[model samples]
Structure formats: C-alpha cells, structure tokens
Target chain A: GIQVEQSPPDLILQEGANSTLRCNFSDSVNNLQWFHQNPWGQLINLFYIPSGTKQNGRLSATTVATERYSLLYISSSQTTDSGVYFCAVASVYGGATNKLIFGTGTLLAVQP
Target chain B: EAGVTQFPSHSVIEKGQTVTLRCDPISGHDNLYWYRRVMGKEIKFLLHFVKESKQDESGMPNNRFLAERTGGTYSTLKVQPAELEDSGVYFCASSQDRVGYSYEQYFGPGTRLTVT
Candidate 1:
C-alpha cells in the first residue's frame, strides 16, 4: 500500500494571506485529489490532479507524478477556509477499483 | 446532480450494541467506496464495490465490520458489538469509473459514529 504524508501539520494565517500545503506519496499514483473538510464535517472536493497543474477560483494545485508529490495553494484565504485539508490518491498499480489512500491532513485556521 | 449521500448523520450506541450506516451514491455510478477516520488519525480506506460485487475490501479493519451493496445501488456498513476504538467519522464516496483512467470520487458528508 502506498503511504501518503502531508506537511505543515498545522497552519494559521490572516484572512487575506496565502499559503501552500504539501503532500508526498511513497509511490507513483494515477489520481490525486485535494479536499477541504469544513467545520460542518463536509468533505469538499477541491481539485483532482494526477499530474500537471489545475486552478479553480482562489485555489490551485500541482502534481509532479514523477516526483511523487502534490501541492495545494490557497490565495486570499478567508476565515471560512479554516478546516482540515486532506490529500488522497489512488496508486497506478493498485487493484481494479483503485481505492484512494488518504494522507495525514493539514489543519488550516484562517483568522479575521 | 446529486453527490453521494449518507444516512444517519450521527449515531451513538453502547459498546455491545450494533449500528448500521448507509450510503447512496450518485445515480449511474458504478464505483462505491467506504473509508473511516478515527480520532487523531488519518482517514483510511475500508472497501470498494463495483456494482453488486465487492471489487476490493482489503482495507477493512477487522471481521467486526461488515459492508454490503445490494443491486449495486445503495450500500450499508454494519458494526456489531462495537468497541470504544470504533468511534470515528465514516465516509462514503462514489465515482463513475475507477478501473479506467480517473474520475472524480464524490464524497458524502460522512456519518459520525460514537461507541460508548
């Protein structure tokens, strides 16, 4: 099984600040996604980047598959962005179902 | 379009009792999965169902946890004689295609289970 690890276990920033979260996997993966678990316990899918880069709204993500790492960038962070950010990925050589392996989440707290 | 949905948003039960959690995937989705996050721990995979068959359940923790997907539609996870360590958030997710390339795996809010 592939191991996923997230860095900057905890983060705090002003509402307007920007931050980057990192995820490193033990092996090559075919699909990678970022999720924000709000205070209400909802897992909001942020981005799905197996490789390359993608952007949505004030958030962006980049995955270097060859290097076995991914990054999530949050710009103009809001207080509502306070939550746990998780990275999940499915290994390229996994079973037919491609079940995701989640990482130790990065807890982000944006203050006003 | 509706995303994955889970029932009984929260449940509290005695250690010796049994509780069942249910998940309904987005219509037409063939890949359903279950994952759990215990206190102070990373979320871990439990199992996956492709239609009515169990595609992969290698991540299931132990025999006390049983999961099923009937008619390849809604799925259920039952924990009998739950233990204190079983208390955590259980998440269910679904994707249209997992065996091929890659697609989004929409997740439900999750069910908070507390074993007293």
Candidate 2:
C-alpha cells in the first residue's frame, strides 16, 4: 500500500491571495490527482498529473514523480475556492484498476 | 458531458436495516469505483468495477457490503443489516481506460448515510 501525505493541513487565505499546497507520496505512482471537495462535499477533479505540469484556469499542478511529490498552486483565489483539497495516488500494480488512496486533505478557507 | 451521478443524496435508516446506494457513471466509461469516508477519516476505497466485472475488491471492509454493476451502465452498493459503523459518505467515481495507466476519476457529489 502507498502512503500519501498532504502538507499545510489547514490554510486560510484572503481573496486574490496565492497559495501552494504540497502532496508527498511514499512510493512511485501511476495515477496522481488533485481534487477539491467543495462546500457541498462535491469532489471536483482539479488535475490529473502523474508527471510534468498542467494549468487549468486559476489552478495549476506540477508532479515530480521521481521525487514522489506534487504541488498544487492556486492564484488569485476566490471565496468559492474554500474547501478541502485532497491528493490521491494509485500504484502501477493496480494497472487499470480504480482504487485511489487519498491523503488527509488540506482544508483551505478563502475569506472573501 | 455529464459527470458521475449518485442517487438518494442522503439516507437515514435504523440499525440492521438494508440500504442501497446507486451510481450512474458517464456514458461510455468502462471503469467505476466505490469509496467511503467515515467521520473524521479520509476517503477509503471500497471496490472497483470494470464494466460489470469486479476488478479489485480488496478494500471492501466485510461481506455485508455487496456491490453490483448490472449491464455495465449503472452500479449499486447494498449494505445488508447496516450497522452504526456503516454510517458515512459513500462516493462513486468513474474513469476511462488509458493505454498504460488509468485516467483521472470523476467523482459524484456522494451519498451521506446515517444509521441509528
């Protein structure tokens, strides 16, 4: 089993502020994703980066697979971004299976 | 275009009662998954279904939890004689099968279950 640890267990930021959250995994993974559990408990997929960097609107993520860690950056944050951000990983052993072990999650509160 | 969808956004039942949760994945998706998150705990994997076949169910806690995907379109998870510990948020997710590795899983809003 792989272990996932997210840093900054809790974060508070003002609107328009920028923050970077980190996720560290114990072993190499073939599937690494960043998810935002909104106020309604809706798990929204933010990024699916196993390697390299990707940007989507105000959110971007970079995964250094070799280092077994990933970073998620949010710029010009808004109140709507307030919620829990989670990082989940699945090892290659699962192959096409779908069991992602989630981290403890980073609770973010973006005050408006 | 639609993402994964689960039925009965919330459920409340007495102990020893039976409860079933439903999940409708995106059209054409071959992979479906079931996960749970108890109070003050991170989300834990329950099982995975690859188009009607059980891929891996090692995460299932016990035999009381039965999951089925008939016809490979929609899936259902049945908890027979549910107990207090079964109370939690059950999440349903789906993803497409890629060449080497799997893709990102699209999750539903999740069903909040409460047992008395």
Candidate 2 lDDT over B94-113, as tens digits, reads 98875764578889999999
Whole-model lDDT for model 1 versus the true structure? 0.92
TM-score of each: 0.96, 0.95
lDDT of 2 at A104: 96
Model 2 clash pairs? none
Report the lDDT tens digits of candidate 1 across residue range A1-112.
7999999999999999999999999988877999999897888999989999999999999999999999999999999899999999998889577788899899999999
CAPRI band for model 1: high
Which regions of candidate 2 are displaced past 4 Å? A95-98, B98-102
* Model 1 spans > 4 angstroms off: B98-101
Task: Specify the CAPRI tier of model 2.
Answer: medium
Q: Which pairs of residues collide in candidate 1?
A: none
Worst 10 residues of 2 chain A by lDDT: A90-99
TM-score of predicted structure 2: 0.95
